[model samples]
Target: MAIGLFYVILLGCVLLNVCFYFYFSKVCFSNPTTYTKNVTPVSVIVCAKNEEENLKRLVPQLLSQDHPNFEIILINDASTDDTRFVIEEYMAQHPQIKMVDVVNNETFWGNKKYALTLGIKKAVNDHLVFIDADCEPASNQWLSLLSSPLKNDTTIVLGYSGYHKAKNSLLNALIRFETVLAAVQYLGYAMRGNPYMGVGRNLAYTSKQFYDVSGFMSHMKVMGGDDDLFVNEAATGNNTAVVIDPEAFTMSKPKQEWNKWWIQKKRHVQTSKLYKTKHKLSLGLFFTSQIFFFIATILGFLFGLQWEAILSLVLIRYVIVWIVMGKGLSRFRESELIPFFPLLELLLVFLQAGLFISNITHKPSRWK
Candidate 1:
């Protein structure tokens, strides 16, 4: 009976992984063609808080975008550092740069959503593109490629944002690996016409859509939902699109310390509670399957259950993962991480389990 139970668990894990592979093979194989000719004017809004150095490095790239008509709106969110001065200096040189300063009120402490709302209101163009202060465009054509999908009546445009490749550290590898995995899931779902979330580091949408969905009012009190939650609330299957062109990618600085990354991830996980029911169930199933797969495979081997069947199931799953994930890695320009996927995949299963547990008891702090 115990051996029979092992077979049941092992088969369940194999079946779940097979479902994921089938989804990847069917929906996420092809890259969407970008529309570059009918580019519309865009307002690129960036919210910054004491990121003077990054602003200096990345803002100029935004200014030099190859697009024909676009404005860069920099929101200085009551930054105590040289953030304001840096923007002032850029404004002096660039005619397209606009700066909105949010003074820090002692009695009323506002989060990132407040600053973003101000920027959206202040935007002159109908289309608004959002990115973090620390993000740098992968190419001069970033603006053109990112905004092109909007011409096709796509209300929400999701672009890829990855961390710059670091030298040597397991933490860095884990960060990059997890990021690639997320991009695959979100982007793949968008391709499958079940669009759910997008990253603010490189996301675009129309002002009309923002106001139509009431713009983050649903979860305004919670910090860190400004991107994913807003997309979840606003995006629909036909209205959303995903762009994975290399030129559309935005690279951001990765968190170096373990504690910092953990806090950042915890805050992000907290927002999952508010995701649409369909998305919540789908994502939950994927993670749960991953944990069960790894755990069941180990037990099957240790308990000396059907050795031939166990080996066959495990090998088949790995092959499927490699083929599907290999194509996804190629599309996202994350080929280097492909060799490390096996080890990282197992580690992430355990890590995600811990994060989900911690999420239930932890209270999220204000977004920095």
Candidate 2:
């Protein structure tokens, strides 16, 4: 009986959070707004790691951004492949682009974080936009759309990132679902005036803001922190802005397999330990509710609880998850996945549980 009561409480908390998330999604993207136009000097940073093929395509697209006073800075982080050669060729062709070469030395800091720090140090702009080598801006207006927010004390710019539509496998669908959730959670928080994280694939912030927060100095030892951790420190009530203009979107490839996806997710979660206390508490509570609810479902079935009551709890839970996720899907333009929400949500709950349990064990996971 106590366990059943506990599950009821868990369900209630989770339902409240779902409602809050729905509210956030509505308020955040209601206006579909962009920042004011300001000629802030902008630098786009690309961290290339064995991205030989992608650079051939993505670099040129990045170089073609229509911003008047922006330069492209590509950091070659210990690439043993043709990534350097491709970059060198591009450098010779484009004078506005600068390249920094780094070795495979994880001596004092994480690889991606160190590469980003190096790029920022060499950047000569008031605003810095970071993107991966495998990603390309959706349109030429990308820079303007991303940088427009700096006019008003909006120090941090959170932009949208999606996967290329070329892949249509189940894995790709799962990645799409994951991207929608990220857009919902982080961008939703920004709407509620409490931005906590940003994605490295397409995020922007002022150079002064980066230095002001010490530029990932504290979380350097961890394998991740280039994006989310940095945002946790820099973004506050009035200092952050989220850009959802379709033209401002960036696209990258989805992971090819479940194992690789798990590792990528684990690497991402490694930085969660560095999140601010409030953010940590919110995420902990959010995750705890889902975990306990799942446990309750299993226990209720095992103990021969009244079938109608068990069905009632399960149906209510699904309805709440659907509504929250539906708002996210509609906001992020991922309505096609609405039909597959049941399977994806179930997979996500299990996946999230694995991540939490693995995190508890504190063992290092292999990077994909």
Candidate 3:
């Protein structure tokens, strides 16, 4: 009976993994090829705190975007550093650039969200595009490509944001792989008209949609969710769109220290609890199946029970994952991580499980 149960469990895991691969293959493979030429006026919003160096470097790239009718709004949120000077210098030369400063206040809301609200209130355009101070656009067409869907009635546009490649660090490779995996799910689901969450690093939507959803009021107390949680509540099949165009991508610096990355990831996972029930179930099932697959495979090998079947099942799942991941990486222009996918996949599964447990036990402090 025990042996029979093991077989059933292993088969279930394999099936679940295949189902996930199919979803990725169907949605990501059939990417939108036709892009509209609708160039609408966009208000690009950036919220920064103590990121003086990054603001000086990346904000220029944003200012130099080739889009004709757009403005860049930078919110210097109580920075003890030279963030204000950096913005002022840029604003002096560029008429389209605007700046808002948020003084340090003991408020109940997260600082990032509060800063974003202030920026949105000052925005003069109907469409808003958001990116972090640390992120740089991949090309001049970044704004054009990101905001094109909005011309066609897409209220929410989700774009890919990748990490800059680092030399000689397994951690960097893992970070890039994890990012690609996440893009596969969020983008794929959006393509399938079941949009859930989006990364704030490179996302766009209408100001009307923001006000319609009350602008992060539901998850206001949480440290994060300025992006994902708002989209979770507001996105729908008819209104949300996904953009994987290489020209539309943005690159951000990855966390170098393990502890820093852990804290960042833990804060991110805290907002998952607020996701809709469907999202919760879908993500929970995927993670549970992944954990079971790894644990059961090891136990089956240790006890020398059905090694042949276990190995076969593992190989089948890996093949599907590899093929799907290859397509997703190609689409997102992260094909460099393809060779490291197998190892990174195994590492991320364990790391994600640990992060989930840590998030449940400890609440993350409210900071940017």
lDDT of 3 by residue, 120-162 (tens): 9999999999999999999988988898889656799999899
How far off is residue 355 in model 3, in Å? 0.9
Q: Go through the candidates in order and give each one's C-alpha lDDT.
A: 0.86, 0.80, 0.88
Q: Which structure among the candidates has the greatest TM-score?
A: 3
Instruction: Return model 1's CA RMSD, one decimal.
Output: 1.5
Query: Relative to the unseen true structure, what is the C-alpha lDDT of residue 302 in candidate 3, on a scale of 0 to 100?
Result: 95
Tell me how far the alpha carbon of residue 254 in candidate 1 is from the true structure, in angstroms, after superposition.
0.5
- The alpha-carbon deviation from the true structure for residue 213 of candidate 3, after best TM-score superposition, in angstroms, is 0.9
Q: Which stretches of candidate 3 lie over 4 Å from their true place?
A: none
- Model 1, residue 125: distance off in Å is 0.3
| Shift of residue 133 alpha carbon in model 3, Å | 0.4
TM-score winner between 2 and 3, please give it.
Answer: 3
| Best-fitting candidate, scored by lDDT | 3
lDDT of 2: 0.80
lDDT tens readout by residue for model 1, 131-172? 999999999988888888885568899999999888888888
RMSD of 2: 2.4
lDDT of 2 at 304: 75
Lowest lDDT 10-residue stretch of candidate 1: 23-32
